[model samples]
Target: MNTQPATRPAFQDRHILVTGAASGIGAAVARQLLAQGARVSAVDLDETGLQRLHAQAPHRAASSRLEDASGHLWTARLDVRDSAQVEQVVAKAQAALGPLDGLASVAGILEMGEVVDLDDAQWQHCFDVNATGVFHVCRAVARRLRERRAGAIVTVSSNAAATPRAGMAAYAASKAAVTQFSRCLGLELAPYGIRVNIVSPGSTDTAMQQAMWAQGSSRAAVIQGDPSRWRLGIPLDKIATPEEIAAAVLFLLSDQASHITLHDLRVDGGATLDQG
Candidate 1:
């Protein structure tokens, strides 16, 4: 049994790049890492949200705040799906923050509609953002980690990947792909001492959740009727909060879980169990 101080900072000098850092789970993870004295680089397409994140830590604000615990964090306004942009940003981040120590892939989208009614463009867009976006960031960061012989990666997946829902076909499938990709990455990267893991969250009470609630309820009679049993409803009896999901990511990235890799850690408040 290994015992250490309960309140020690396990990631004091680690550099972490978090996508979707503008809101929801990504934002929470960034904040948690900062509080633990880790160097953190955050990116999102929402420049306004990035500004707000910086504003929250003005005392520690600097151009590369993500790399410098005492200075401002780095915020990039780039879409994860853009491979060129992702490569450029990763290089810049490593140059500014030092080598890439970790990556948290949290940028994704969920579009709910019957698959037959969904357009090809919509399906492509979701996969491009969710699945391909992950590929871009992971490939870029893992390359550096492999060269250095150390690093960790945690991707945000979804419970929908395991339990199919009526209106979440595209979203579920995208996450399923992400899960498989992460597993493959784990095996391929193990030789270089890199660990890859996935965190699959159920409906969390983020802005995304609110949007989903509205979408399903817009047709209350059609969606909530006895025939459907409101099967698509969040299975936890209530939605989780973003912080809950972030905690799981923090654990997977920390030294406490150094031996774990290539697995899906679900933080859905027993939502999947209820459905099962």
Candidate 2:
């Protein structure tokens, strides 16, 4: 009788880097990757949140005894806004965790206001983190992945990128930028056997979403369309969990999606009415 343990995880022995790992979608992706036996290099600007994530997935630790084992999990404090900092961190993470097999850029921010009322800083900041931040990480990782001749990359965009939303002009535009950028990058990396894709989630049950909710009516408002705001409700009639989004991301990163590339998978519960 063969009693050798079967590898239950698809990501076992693979190295993946996740941005925005402190909270929301990034944190969820990190947790799922760790659970799936991936060597994860979790990066985010929030030091405390990274610590909590590291502690929660102790079993995923590279070494049960060593405090800083890079075998299973590693965490780094990173601000994606700075290109140099992003480059340095990616290098350090790749060095510590091993060559990267996958990269998930989940770091983003939200600032809402009427276009007329929105300040210059707000608009720039939105693009800075949402679009430029993605550019920074993707550029850094793509170089190494290209050299290795293989890898998968998933960028977490938003449904708003496809559909218009009131008071979300900046956020919507930034997401649009990432969506197009990912597709173009996919084209560029195709010859190298590297795949790039996008996952656009809508109204997920994350701190970022909850923060946008009103005291009592917000949840219902999100479920039931608000014609006044030119917003349609989710057809599924519920918010998504971060894990749900993470699942889609993992699928794209895994071999199950080997033939898929430059695809934009929307996880919006038909919220956009499938427009365009």
Candidate 3:
């Protein structure tokens, strides 16, 4: 693990709400923020994953944790698709951790069926989880931050949003919706001192990717392309690690990016650029 030493505790005493913090990209972002001295309120649908994260303190110094926690981490089980549940969780998280200084919307779902082959329910579920879930979480968080007049938001999208994939129409459309949503939100939030942005990752070696690939034919065949140009369809020779994607999220949320917003930062190892 190549951990970067903190340049400064830019998020010290600040609170961040991380959706899908149970695992993968979300979990990695939470760990990075916690390590940088931020007090985080991690939320996810997986209660067991949250508990495990809480049990394992990501920080070295006990004092780095939010006091009164008894060495435990702040967490909540949230289903982002439920609007009411999202609102309730956001309210509780804010009260527990103080004002939310930032958010990383990483919770999303993926599907791999062609347009005609995908059922309406399947398409809706993809959009509901990946697109609507973002709206709910971002709106809930933004409402509070707007009152405070300061915050930053980074959303995880995908390279497929802009580049076509054979059997990923639903997933790609949902991600594309996410990209546009974030851009619009960025414009709207700027006046309130809030910034919104998107981070679109290329093929990543996460459990979700493996599972989706398993349900299909050969994974290599689905993702492979030319070798001479070193420009495979997935770009990277090996799938990117979750932590690598988290780094891009961290950069967007940091003060170093105060002037940046509405940008689709493609952390795709040049995959997006290769689309023709």
lDDT of each: 0.82, 0.90, 0.82
**RMSD values, in order shown:** 4.0, 2.6, 4.8
List where candidate 2 sits over 4 angstroms from the true fold.
Answer: 1-8, 60-67, 214-217
Estimate TM-scores for all models: 0.89, 0.94, 0.88
Error of 2 at 139 (Å): 0.4
Query: On residues 15-75, what C-alpha lDDT tens digit does candidate 1 reach at each position?
Result: 9999999999999988888888777788899888877787775346445333233353677
* Prediction 3 global C-alpha lDDT: 0.82
lDDT of 3 by residue, 157-244 (tens): 9988888776788999999999999999999999999999899998777778888668854457435753543335555545678999
lDDT minimum window of 10 residues, candidate 2 = 61-70
lDDT at position 54, candidate 3: 75
> In every candidate, how many clashes are there?
7, 1, 0
Models sorted by TM-score, best on top: 2, 1, 3
In model 2, which residue pairs have backbone atoms overlapping below 3 Å? 62-72
lDDT rank, highest first?
2, 3, 1
Once fitted onto the true fold, the runs of candidate 1 whose alpha carbons sit more than 4 angstroms away are 1-7, 62-72, 218-236, 274-276
Score candidate 1 by lDDT: 0.82
